[model samples]
Target: MKKGLFIFCFTMFIAFASKAQDNTSLPAKYQEKMTSIFNKIPEVTSSAATSLIDFAKSMLGKPYVYASSNPDRGFDCSGFVSYVFSNFGFKVPRSSREFAGAGTPVKLADAKVGDVLIFTGTNPRVRKIGHVGIIYSIENGEIKFIHSTSGKAHGVTVTEFNDYYKSRFMKAVSIVE
Candidate 1:
């Protein structure tokens, strides 16, 4: 009886070890199985370009909070961008001004989705990147963007760069992947 118990325990231990090893050094057959499970999201937009849109869509209807960083708690303008991109593995700067430095500066005509839009409209006295938003789409010569606003309509909302946005438009930068 003692001999049988010893063998049983040893076999169990070996099986456990093999399973652990297989996790790291996965067998080719098991890897094929994993591919089916892994949702390989296709790149609708170029790298880093659509990360914001994907993150924002997932966060639709989240409330906006001042200086809050988490999606559950909602986010501020800068926090919203920071949380969204960072969640998708992109290293985004925390504040709006810092994030403005992350990408290449794109002209208004050259602006594309996933580009960071900076504005000085938030504070007139300041001629720097005061507010931030992510470009989502452009249609019929109209540009739409997603950003967290304060007080009214607080949360991530898609606003257009029509006359209203152009009035407050500062500049745009591209976060090249």
Candidate 2:
């Protein structure tokens, strides 16, 4: 009985070890997946950007509706950003994808509050910028932003730009300056 148990435990250990190795050394099928999973701001970068971010944050909990730009009626991702920035006196593109080309392109590491963060859709083949968010802050190496999502949260909310987002990240556009 003791010998049998030892063999069983050894087999289990080998199985788990191999699984861990697989994860650490992601195979070809997971190379893109790993890149997405593995994959910041400035100052004078002051009041205007801060105000815009604050305004967007204020709209948190508002419903997310497709193609609507009115805050009270609810807003889609781009609409929410458009509405907020318009209130602050900047004209912006009406769609998330359009914003990809609207402002000066900034490296992801150089993003600041009020910058637009563009992302591709969840599908690997979809390369278009399908979502947008306004940068709020970067803290402890985590970039957080505000946007209205049709996602599980289903409304305007602040979210950490984590691994899932990294996978979809397309570009960052600086609109405040």
Candidate 3:
């Protein structure tokens, strides 16, 4: 069991390191810090959540297409979340706004992998659900999410829940218990 745990932790570290390298938006120092924190996370015991996150990661680099859910054609923010949950046999809201009332609400601090995170539109002043993503991981009290974004990256990517997102963050909901 000890060996297995070590291997898992090591593999996770390598994976995070590679992802951090790919993400150029964050400064070198921030990437290194995030990778270090990822290494210290306890082994995730939920197979279902792991599977969902893995699947979501597989879509990284896919383009962000507005009002579309097809992987081949790409997906918008809500479309990406909808497609991921639907692929896992979960009935989820198709639109971002619809997700406001879907699933059981989970506090931001207590959110886990596979939970859907809703956020307001680009203009946070609107105060309405217009974007969504899946919690990719939570380590050292920091949350990273996977979503199809039209921002700088312009594709499916994992993003840290930083100040920009915090201002737009509406709530998080658990789809897989």
Candidate 4:
């Protein structure tokens, strides 16, 4: 009967709609930002946090270059973030200057370990957004971050968020979940 045929078509339509939902893929950035998308560690269980650290630790001791961001090889300030985020399926900005404006701004008091620290007062001004790092710790009023320095003391290193860093700091951004 016509009525029976209508019911069958309606049911098919509903099934197809649900199926479409399952086929949607998240943006590379959001995918990495999701808390369950990659390998995890105790320091970070969420995908964003884990991805950020993995990106940093993966380059331990790698020499800092002008614009490199490859762990198997070398990395620069922005190259470091771009490489790691892209490695895990996130679309990070290509340059440090562009990267400075990619995340939600947060206050120093409220910044979490996974937050991004932007610095622009060191050498090259924020003509773009220069110098970025991942927050490693925020304990007892002190903040620590990991980044590649290219001054007298260069290379990827971890340092505290003190007057030295504060003076050159651009702003803090929350680019991860």
Every candidate's CA RMSD: 11.8, 18.1, 11.4, 12.6
TM-score, candidate number 1: 0.68
Top-down TM-score ranking: 3, 2, 1, 4
Scanning candidate 4 in windows of ten residues, the lowest lDDT window is: 35-44
N/CA/C clash count, model 3: 0
Model 3, span 1-177: residue lDDT tens? 999999999799778766765555878778777766655554444878999999999999999999999999999998999999999899998899999999999998888988999999999888988999999988889999999999999999999999999999999999898
Please give, for residues 1-177, the per-residue lDDT of candidate 1 as tens digits. Answer: 999999899788657644654353678778756554333323422756665587677876789888887888988888998887777777878888786578788898988888888876455465766778888898777888888887367788888876656756777887655
lDDT (C-alpha) at residue 124 in model 3: 86
Q: What ranges in model 4 sit over 4 Å off?
A: 1-47, 121-128
Which window of ten consecutive residues has the lowest lDDT sum in model 1? 36-45
lDDT of 2 by residue, 1-177 (tens): 999999899788657644554354667787666445433012322878877877887899999899988877899998998999899889899998799789899998888777999988666367888899999898877899999999998889999998888888999999888
- In model 2, pairs of residues that clash are none
Whole-model lDDT per candidate: 0.76, 0.83, 0.90, 0.71
Residue 14 alpha-carbon offset, candidate 4, angstroms? 29
- Per-model clash counts, in order, read 0, 0, 0, 5
Off by over 4 Å in 2: 1-45
TM-score of each: 0.68, 0.73, 0.75, 0.66
